[model samples]
Target: MAKSTLTPELAARFASIALGHVRREYPNKPDHTLAGPQDAQTPSQLHPVFYGSYDWHSCVHSYWMLARLLRLFPDLPVAADIRALFDEQFVAEKIAVECAYLAAPTARGFKRPYGWGWLLKLAEELALHDDRRWSERLRPLAEIFAQRFRDFLPLATYPVRVGTHFNTAFGLRMAMDYAVVTDDRDLAALLGETGRRWYGADADCPAWGEPSGDDFQSSALIEAECMRRLLPAEEFLPWFDRFLPRIAQREPATLFRPATVTDRSDGKIAHLDGLNLSRAWCWRSIASALPECDARRAIAEETADRHLAAGMPRIAGDYMGEHWLASFAVLALEA
Candidate 1:
C-alpha cells in the first residue's frame, strides 16, 4: 500500500506547528538591507504585518499554510486562532505600514521576487475561501507586489535557476496562483510570456548538480513545476520528456535522492530539509502532469514519497528548521 499523505490529522499538526512561530517575534532574523544608520528598526517595527517566523518570507508563507489548512479542514482546532491573527494584522493600517516600507528609497528591491512571491501566495490562499473579505483587505498589498512582478519580470533577462530563495521558477509558480483566482489577465499574460522566455526551451536537464548546502528548493524540480503551469497539457508532456529524459533510467541520480542536513542548529544549512519537501511537492506535480502510461509518472511519484519521507521526520527538531519547515511540508503534502 502507498504511504498516506495529506491526512486531516497531519494537516492539523502542521497547522499547529506553523501557528506557534507565525507570531513569535523573538530571536528574529530580519532580511533588512539597510541603506544607512537611519534605516535601523526592529523586525516587528519595520514589517508590522510580517515580522515573525524567523524571516519575512517565512512569516508570509506560514500565513499561507494556515489559510490553506483552514480552507481544506475548517474544523481544525486552530481555526479561530488563524482567523484572529488575520483580523489583528491583515488590516488597512498595518498593510499601509508594509507598503510604506516598500516605498522607501532603501527598500527599492526589499524582498524582491521571493518575499514578494510569497506575499502574493498568501493573498491567493485567502482568495480561495467563500469569504472575499480577506481577499479584499489584502488586495492593496497584493496589487503592490503584482505591479512589482509586472515591472520586474520584463527586465530579468535570465532565470535564477538555483535551489535557494532567489529561484525564479518558484516565485513565478506562486505568482501564477494569485493570477488565476484574481482573474488578472494582465498578470497571467505576463507570466506566460516570461515563463516561456526563461524556461520554454529547457531540454535534457543535467540534474546532477543539486542541493547546495543552503538550498531549500530543487532548481530542476521547481523549473519543472513552472513549465507545467505555463504550458498546455499536450505541450508540457513533450517538454517534460526532453527535460528529464532519463527518469526511466534515473540518470540524474541526484534528483531521486534527498539531501542530508548536517546541522539543523545552523539556520542556512538547515534549508536542506526544505529542499526535500520542495522536491516532493514538485515531484508530485510532475507526476500529476504526466500521462498515466508514462514511466516517468511512477518514477515521479516514488521519488516524491522518498523525499517526503526524508524531510517530514525533521520538521520540528530545532528552531532553525522548525521556523519554516511546516510551510514546505504543507506545500508537499497538499501537492
Candidate 2:
C-alpha cells in the first residue's frame, strides 16, 4: 500500500470537525469542564467525564487538544478558554503538587494515579505559553514533583509500572521548560536528572510486553514521545522501532473491550470495556511518528478513520476516543 496523502480540503475538514466537536461538546460554563448532554445515560456519553470527574488528566488532555487546534487554526474561539482552564483548574489548584502521591484521592475516592504524565505534559505546554502567572503557578508543582519522585515510582498498578515513564518524562519536560522559562540552571538540572532516570532505569522493564490494544499503545506512545523529546536519539530510538510493528498491527475491536472485570467465575468481558481509550490513542500516536511510509500511513489513516466513524465520542481523557480524534487530526493535518 502506498502512503495516503492528505489534501488541504481533507485537513480542513478534519480540523473543522475537531474544532466543532470541541466547541459543541465542551460545556459553556467558566468552570472549564465538559459535561455529558442531558440525554447522556452511560459514562461514555459524558463529554469529558467519561473517565470520571474532571481532574488533571482530563484537563490536560483537553489542553493538548486545544493546543493542537490552536496550532492548526489560530482563530478558533476556544483557545483562550483552554488556556484559562490550564491556569485555573490545573495550575491554580496545584494538582501536580497536592496530588503528587500515586495513591491520591480522586473526586470519586482513593484511586491510583495512572495519568500523571499527562498533567506534567500540560505544565510543559503552559510553560511554553510564557505567561508570568503560569510560571509562578508551575514552579511550586515542579518542586513538589521533584521531591516526591521516589514516592510515585514503586506503586503497583497495571499501567503505573510502564506508565510512570510518561509521568516522569513530563516532570522532566516541565522541569526543563521551567528552567528555560526562569533561567534557573539548578531547576533545569534537577528536572533533567528526573527525566533521565524516568526514561533510564526507572521505567525499563525486563519484558517489553505487547500492549493489549490501540488504547494501551496510545498511552504508551504518549510516554514514549515524551521520552524521545527528553532523551538522546540513540537511547530511545530502539524502543520506538521495537513497538512500531505491533502498533501497526492493532485491530479496532481491541478497543471496545470492557474496562474492568467483575468476576473470575464468569469468563466474560465487563461493561467497563468501552472506557479504555488510552491504548488506542497511544497506537495512533505511534503511527503518526512514522516516516510516512506506505504501510504505516495506511494503518494510521484507516485505523483513525475507522475508529472515529465507529461511534467513538470525542470526550476528554477518554483516551480511546480522544486519541482516535487526536491521532487522525495530527496525521491528516501533517500529511
Candidate 3:
C-alpha cells in the first residue's frame, strides 16, 4: 500500500498549538506535571464535561495524542518534551490498572471510562517501537482484561450492559493485542466471539442492543481492526468497505456538537458544551485500518486539519475528545 503524505504546513500547525496548550496550561514544566492551583480546580475547569476531572481514562487518551505527536515529528524538540510528559504523567502501571479495572469513579461522576482502549492500543504501538520494558509492564493489565472478558461473556446474564462501553471496548482491544504479542489462540477466539456477538457479523454495527454514539462507532472500529488481523482479507474487506464511510459521515455530529443548556429546577440554565475527541480517535482507527479507502482518507485528512487549527488544550478534561490527535498524527506522518 502507498503511504499517505503529511503536509508540512499541517504538521507545524498541530505541533505548535498542542505544544502551546501544554506550555500555557502546565506552565513551569516542560512535561504535563500537575501541582498547586491546577490540581485544585474542579474537573470542569479543564473542559466542559464534569467527568473530565480525576478520570484516568481521559488522562490516558491525552497521552495517546502526545505519543502520536512524538511519532510524527520526532525531530522536533517539543515532541521529546511531550514524550517525557507521557512517560511521567500518563504511562504508569498503577494508573492503567485503576482506569481499566476499578469502579469507584462511576459513583463520583460519569459512569463512562472515557476511551481507555486507546491507552492499550497506544501501548501496543509503543511496544512495536521496541519499548519492550513498557510492553512487558503492560502485560499484566491485559491479563486482568482477559479475566474481565470472561466475566462479561453471557450478554443476557450479565448484570447490566449499558455502562460497560469502556470496559467491553478496552477488554476486546487488550485481548486482541495480547493475543498478537503472546500468540494465544484462546484469547483471540474469545475476542472474536465477543466481537461477533456484540458488534454484528462483520462487527459493523451495535451488537448488544443500542449503544451510545462513542460506544457504537469506537467499538465497531476496534472490532473491525481485530477481526481484520484474524480473519481472511476477503471475509472482512466487504464489511470494512461498507462501514467506513458510514462511520466517517456520522461521527462529526455525534461528537462535536455544542453543549445545550438544561433548565434546573432552581431556575438556572446549566451550560453543557465540550468536544469529546474519542470520535476523532475512532476515525483514526478507521483510517489506520483502511488507509486506501477514499472516503475514509478524505475524512481523516479533513479532521486532522480541523483539530490542528482548533488549538484546544489536550489534557484529561479533553482526553476523550482529543486522544485521536496522536493517532491522526501517526497516520498522517506515516502516510
Judging by TM-score against the true structure, name the best candidate.
Answer: 1
Better of 1 and 2 by TM-score: 1
Query: How well does model 3 score by local distance difference test?
Result: 0.43
Candidate 3 per-residue lDDT over residues 108-224, each given as its tens digit: 222222343444555655566544555565555545544445554554232123323344543465446646656667767866666556544342343333234223233444455
TM-score of 1: 0.97
Where does the lowest 10-residue lDDT sum fall in candidate 3? Answer: 266-275
Q: How many residue pairs clash in each candidate?
A: 0, 19, 9
Cα lDDT for residue 103, model 3? Answer: 36
Task: Give candidate 1 regions above 4 Å deviation.
Answer: none
Ranking by TM-score: 1, 3, 2
Clashing pairs in 1: none
Model 1 sits at a Cα RMSD from the real structure of: 1.2
| Tens-digit lDDT track of model 2 for 1-335 | 23333444444444444443333333221212223353333322322321222233433444544544555555555556545544554454444434433233322221213333344444555555635566456656545543343344443122233332233343443345435544666655554555555554433322233233222223344456555555555665575555343444543234323234232222122112222333344335445555676475456555544433322333223433432234333433343
By summed lDDT, which 10 consecutive residues of candidate 1 come out lowest? 1-10
